[model samples]
Target: MTDPAAAQAPTTVLGASTPRTPPARLGVAVVHDLVEAIVTGEVQPGAVLPPEGVLSQTFGVSRTVIRESVKRVEEKGLLTVAQGRGTSVNEASAWNVLDPVVLSALVEHDDSLGILDELAVVRGVLEGSMANAAAGRRTAERTAALQHALDHMHETIDDFDAYSQADVDFHFTVMEQSGTRLAPTITRILFDRARESSRFVGAPAAEALRLTLEEHQAVLDAIEAGDAAGAQRAMEHHIAEAWARRRLPTARD
Candidate 1:
């Protein structure tokens, strides 16, 4: 028994609100719109999408473009196309959250900040393990490089942009020192995506830079001393606390 009011609720049409997407980028635009629609729950799980013809008219694209774009979205694990039935959205558990397009949409449209909070938890676990590994495998050269990165952060502490990059460099150094390829690669993807979202990089506390610097120092000291447990705890705490400081409050009713 679907509510009549809910059934009549307006669906968000990206093309209606935004400037026209360029002809050359129609496919990409369509895919982005579809992804955004699903991620924001404009189209809920199990809801069959409108026919290709309808979507074509809605997006001002040819039926072929709409078909292709739907396929692209399907490839990202957001849709299921079946014979004798229209294309339907899959559940969130079925989504390929690592896909850049999917991930970006998830972060950008996360009104409740739940996605970012989950991101922080996953990052804390992964980076904590990496930091533990780094402590066990630290070399003099690697330690020196990490020290230099921290020094650069100190030098650029007053410059937010520069300090941010230096902060990335320091983390990169630690990940590289850990000598595990896959974890670093995946962590980088997650970190990069989160950093790119303004919501995830929300207003920071006044002592943000100083506190961040101190946290980095603690991580470095633990790693340099080969204190694996200490390094792991320090790195986990830093990520968890950093996200807490920057996480924005969602608008309430």
Candidate 2:
């Protein structure tokens, strides 16, 4: 049984502001708060949520809004709603990490940077496979386009923003040449999400840009030579090493 006192959610925990969430977006606000609370461990796994009446009062929304919001959180694998026992947060392992809201919350709260580390590993594997496929499927035109992207990166090496974009262009060119739909889509989503995290965008030293240029050149050479195995290795090495160079050390490290 849940301790009665534990069920009383702090009003601030629900993100109740002085003005309160407008009725039009009460459900969304409630859901966002609940997810963040669960993800950040403000609400621990197996802790019962407050009763519907308490929640409605705390959030200043109707009981109906509370029910709907809780249901949405349950659907995201963050909550287990027992019929009579009340809703409880699930373990982090149960979360839908790919869900945009869940992913955003995880990234925002990732103080140790473990999530970004895992993100890099996943990107390296997926991008390596794509590079391999691109090598096999490369036509003269596709190879030329990739070379052009590499050239742009070289030209813009002094301009961080331009070089960063060109780097993305180089990767996109390879993914496009692979002609695989699902993998590219998933990779793009993960890549975009990681890029949004400041922890994943640590300051790059001038030497870092030079090293990146060298890495890109290696990948390009392997792909242009149609060395599928070599391309896969080059792409994987670049992603993993690039992330290592940028990853900020935490106390946990």
- The C-alpha TM-scores of every prediction are 0.90, 0.88
What C-alpha RMSD separates each model from the true structure?
Answer: 4.3, 4.6
Which parts of model 2 are misplaced by more than 4 Å? 1-24
- Against the reference, the lDDT scores of all candidates come to 0.88, 0.88
Clashing residue pairs in candidate 1 (N, C-alpha, C atoms within 3 angstroms): none
Give the alpha carbon lDDT tens digit for every residue of 96-196 in model 1: 99999999999888778888999999988988999999999988887899899999999998778888899899998888999899989888988898888
TM for candidate 1 is 0.90
Candidate 2 lDDT over residue span 166-195, tens digit each:
999999999999889988888888888888
Model 1 stretches astray by more than 4 angstroms: 1-11, 14-23
Model 1: per-residue Cα lDDT at residue 147: 94
Best model per TM-score = 1
